[model samples]
Target: VNIDYLKKHADELKRVAASVLTGTVTASLLINKLQSYPRQNNLMYVLQSYGQLVKTIFICKYLLQLPLRHRINTQLNKGEQLHNLRVYLWFGGDGIIRKKQEKQQQVTARCLNLLTNIVMVWNTVYIQEILKQLQKEGYQVDEKDLEHISPAPFEHINRLGKYDFNDEIRLQENGLRALRPPVDKR
Candidate 1:
């Protein structure tokens, strides 16, 4: 994240990391480490390379995860929002992602996540007003509680759409032909 420090030590760090690389390794997965005890014959090269390999492994693990630290935190925050989204999706006492096949279920879940996010963004103003009123009344709520996600509030949405996955859905103008739009949101 700090460009100045990266610029100054970039070459130095690269050199140090390179210098840590050990004995020549072949393509297949495992690396057989050869080391000798004090009583063993001359195998100094193998012994020294074993130690270097361990050190390199440790260094690479640490560096590999360093750049992902922020992304991991963001994932943690998004996880909390999933709880509320699940509650909304549980309209029929279960979410729409109850498929037996793991792959199919994953696809269903991702679609639901996107749909939920869209609904929350569309109702941003309504959600903000609620949060503002709570704050004015001296509630001790965190601003994060009013992030770009809201509970599923589609009172007019048809929860009884064809339950059978094999049935083709009727549509008109790219919208569900059998469903009714909410006459009023209030």
Candidate 2:
């Protein structure tokens, strides 16, 4: 199986998986009925690719929510100020202090949840690749041992996406669509 093909068509593979899961068609059934190719040969790679596709969808969804979350946080902070005023009037001192602590806990929990979700998505996408690369380098790594890594999948993808050639190509294509560079530049 060609890794380049897998990388180039990752998004399409993901769409296939999603269509299968959503009952448009059964991709697994199609794979199973194939007599020419053995499942073990490329199953892991395909699964990993599908996982990455899911992660990309999640990241896109998360980005859409970001502005709304910021707005909500801003409103919450403003509400806290009003709450503070009420507490000062009613309790005469330090009433807003408890609210502040609660707010801190709430914010910390939200941040942790966001981080965990991102990590879980990333791990699903690239854990197999990481293990494969490590084994290729003669490093012993256990599946269970990878749980301690920091920065969730989206974060890692964002970092790796910076250096990804396919992404660059896509961006360049888009740039050409919007603003055609000179033919000599190509």
Candidate 3:
């Protein structure tokens, strides 16, 4: 973090930890060497930075796993989207509902839970009907693929602003198309 300190470790200071961490043994050896040198707070910016550098390197390494990272990102995004959907259904989520009062928190939390439960119940029926319809159209449907499908995007509910509460709904045609596995073209 200082002039001469950085001047000493200049090359390393410029190089990212991930590049160093690419070598498994190199990272460990460097870490051990940094540890064994001495224990001083400011003197060990190089040492302290190694932790972050190694983590960055580790993350960089995993970043190469395009499919794996994409899958994880998508699953995480799905969870976030479901939360957003719940917030849409309940108006107290001004994007910061977690910091709300205890009563509002309890009510919203309970309502979200209740909504999740209802969606779960409806999801089973929706998948079954989708499979039935797909088979009826001569496309072979697999039951296993529907195992993780949720009904979050089934937006045909009656929860618009300043309207009468009606629970009846109609299915959207394209809801489960992507979720269905490729047709057994054999």
Best by TM-score: 3
- By TM-score, how accurate is candidate 3? 0.45
**lDDT of all predictions, in order shown?**
0.54, 0.55, 0.64
Stretches of candidate 1 off by over 4 Å are: 1-82, 93-96, 125-186
Q: What is the C-alpha local distance difference test score of candidate 2?
A: 0.55
Candidate 3 lDDT, 30-133, residue by residue in tens: 65666787565443586565556667776887788886676676677678767866766676556455845899878867877898768756666666776777
Please rank every candidate by lDDT, starting with the best: 3, 2, 1
Cα lDDT for residue 68, candidate 2: 58
Best by lDDT: 3
Model 3 per-residue lDDT at 8:
75
Q: Work out the TM-score per prediction.
A: 0.29, 0.21, 0.45
Error of 2 at 46 (Å): 55
Q: What lDDT does candidate 1 reach at residue 144?
A: 60
> What is the descending TM-score order?
3, 1, 2
Number of colliding residue pairs in each model: 0, 2, 1
